[model samples]
Target: MSRFGPVKIVYSDRFLLHDTGGGDHPETAARLEVIWRSLKKGPLAGNIEILEPRQVDRGLLLSVHTEDYIFRFEEACLSGMEMLGHPDNRICYESYNVALLSAGASQTGIDFLEKGQAPSRVFCCIRPPGHHSEAALALGFCFLNNVAIAAKYWQQQYGRQRVFILDFDAHHGNGIQEIFDEDPDVFYVSIHEHPTFSFPGTGYEEDRGSGAGDGYTMNIALPPGSSDAEVLKAMEDKVAGAIEEFQPDCIIAAAGFDAHEYDDMSGLAYSTRLYGHIGRHLSAWADIYCDGRLVSILEGGYSLDALGPSVEIYLGGLCLEA
Candidate 1:
C-alpha cells in the first residue's frame, strides 16, 4: 500500500513563529513567511488547517521537564532576559510562552490524528525547534522537547506498548535520546553528524539505550563531509529496518533541514532534493506500520534559501488532500 495519502499541515498565527527573534537571525519569521507563501501557491493550501497554537499547561510540560526546571524556565522567560544558548536563542518572556504554545501544537496535532479528525500525516510548522532541548534543560535553539513530549503523551493516553521516534536533524537530538534512553516503550532513531565533530555530541552507535531499552535506540553517525548518497543509504538501510521491527502505534519526526549543504551551520552535503526523498520514505513507512499516522515537527535549518524549498518538496511528497 502506498503511504501517500491526505496530509494535514498544522500552524498558528500567534507569536509561535517568533519564539526567539533577532535581526538577521538564521531562524526568523522570514523562514515561515516563505513556507506560507509557497504553500499558498500549492494545491495543498486548500486542505491546510491554520490553527492557533494552544498553550501547553504546566502539567503537560512537566511530563518531560522537571518541575524545578520548568519553574526556572518560566522565571527566566518572565524576566525578559536571554535564556538557553547564546543571544541567538535568547528569548523574551512572551517568546517563551510562544515556544510552549508551539510545543502544545504538537500535542494537539497528535490528538487530532488519534481522533481521526485528520489524516495520519501531520506537519507542525511552528519554530524555535525543540530537538536540541532536553527534559530539564534548554540548549541549542530549543527550550522544550516537543516531539519527545508528544511521544510520551501518546503512550500514556493510548497505552501503546511501543512508539517510534525518528530524528533527522543535522545535529544529534541528544536531548530526546537522553530523555527516552531507558524507556523501552519509545524507540529513538537518529541519523546525524558524528558526535566527534558536532554540537551536543552524543549520537555514537555505541550509545544505545540501557537496560531493557538496549537496541531500541539506533544512531547513524556520519562524518562531517558525508554526501547525500551516504545519508540516503543510512536511512534506507538503518532507519527503515528499525521502523519495521519496532511496529510503533505512531511516528514522530524531528525534521531538520540544516543538513542541506546550503546551510552554513552544517558541513554535511545534502541537497533539498534529498529531503524530498526522506519525506517520501517516511510516508511509505507510515503507511505500512502506523496506519499512515505521522507527525513532523521542525527542529533545525539555518539557510532560508534551502529551508523554504525543502519544506515545499516534503509537503509535495506528503500528498496533501483537497
Candidate 2:
C-alpha cells in the first residue's frame, strides 16, 4: 500500500467522447485508455481509487473563461465546426460538454482534498489538455484551462488564496500564465521547451510577473535535446526556492508527459524514469509547503506507448513513502 493512501483518480468515460477527427491527431481517446490500462497493471495499481467527475458549474467556468468565449465555443461545436479559433484545436459537437467536465475534474479532485474525503494527493486524468487554452481562445488542442479554473475555485470556495502552479509540460502553458500573470494570489511556474523553438511562443525566462505580481511567474526555458538531469536541476535550483518564498496554500501540478524522450511532441529528450523523479519532488514539496495538498491535472503527452508507462511511473512516485 502507498504511504499516501489510495490516490484518487477523477475521470469518466465522457472524456473520451470529445472526438478529435482522428487522422494524425495526437490527442485522442486512446491516450486515456492506455493510461488506464497501464495504471491497472503497474506498480501503483492497488493504490488507486477511481472516481467520476461532476460537470463544472457554468459559474465556475466563467470564473476563468469569458462568457463570450464560452458561447462561441459551444456554438462552434454545435454548429458543426471541426475546429475552434485555431485548427490545432480540433473539436466535435460533444467537445464543449467534455471540456467542461475536463475542467471540473480538477474541481472534483480539490473537493475531495478540502473535504478530507480520500487522499491528500489526487490526479485528474480527464483531458482535452488545458494548459494551451486561453480565456477567450483555444490553442494547442485545448479548450478550457483546467488547472487555472481549479486554482480559482480553490480560492473562492475554500479561501486558499495563494496557489502555486508548477507546469512541467514540454510546451508552455501560455493560457495559465496569462490568466494569473497579474494576480499575486496565484504563482505560475513553468519549465518548458524554449519558446523560440516551440509552439505558442511564450514563457521566456525574463518574462516574470507584472506589477504586484512581479517575480511571481518563473519560466525555466530548456533547450532542445534537454534531458532528465536538466529538469531535476531546474526543480531543485529554481523551483524549490520559489516555492519556499511563496509558501502557497496549495500546489497544482500541470502534469504533462510529452517531454519523455520517445514522445515527438517536443524536441526535449526526457526518460520515462524522469517522471517518477518529478512526482517525488512534487510530493515532497506538497508535504512541506502545503499540508500535503497536491493535485495533478493532466496536460500533454501524445506518444501512446510512452504516455501510459510515464503516467504509471509518475503516480508510483507520488505514492512512495517519505
Number of the top candidate by lDDT? Answer: 2
Candidate 1, residues 102-128: lDDT per residue as tens digits? 788877777777887445567888777
Q: Model-by-model lDDT, in order? A: 0.78, 0.91
Evaluate model 2: give its TM-score.
0.98
Q: Which lDDT tens digits does candidate 2 get at residues 5-65?
A: 8888999999999999989989999999999999888777777888789888889899999
Overlapping backbone residue pairs in candidate 2 total: 0
Residue pairs clashing in model 1 are 77-93
Model 2 stretches with alpha carbons more than 4 Å out? none
Error of 1 at 180 (Å): 0.4
Index of the highest-TM-score prediction? 2
Evaluate model 2: give its lDDT: 0.91
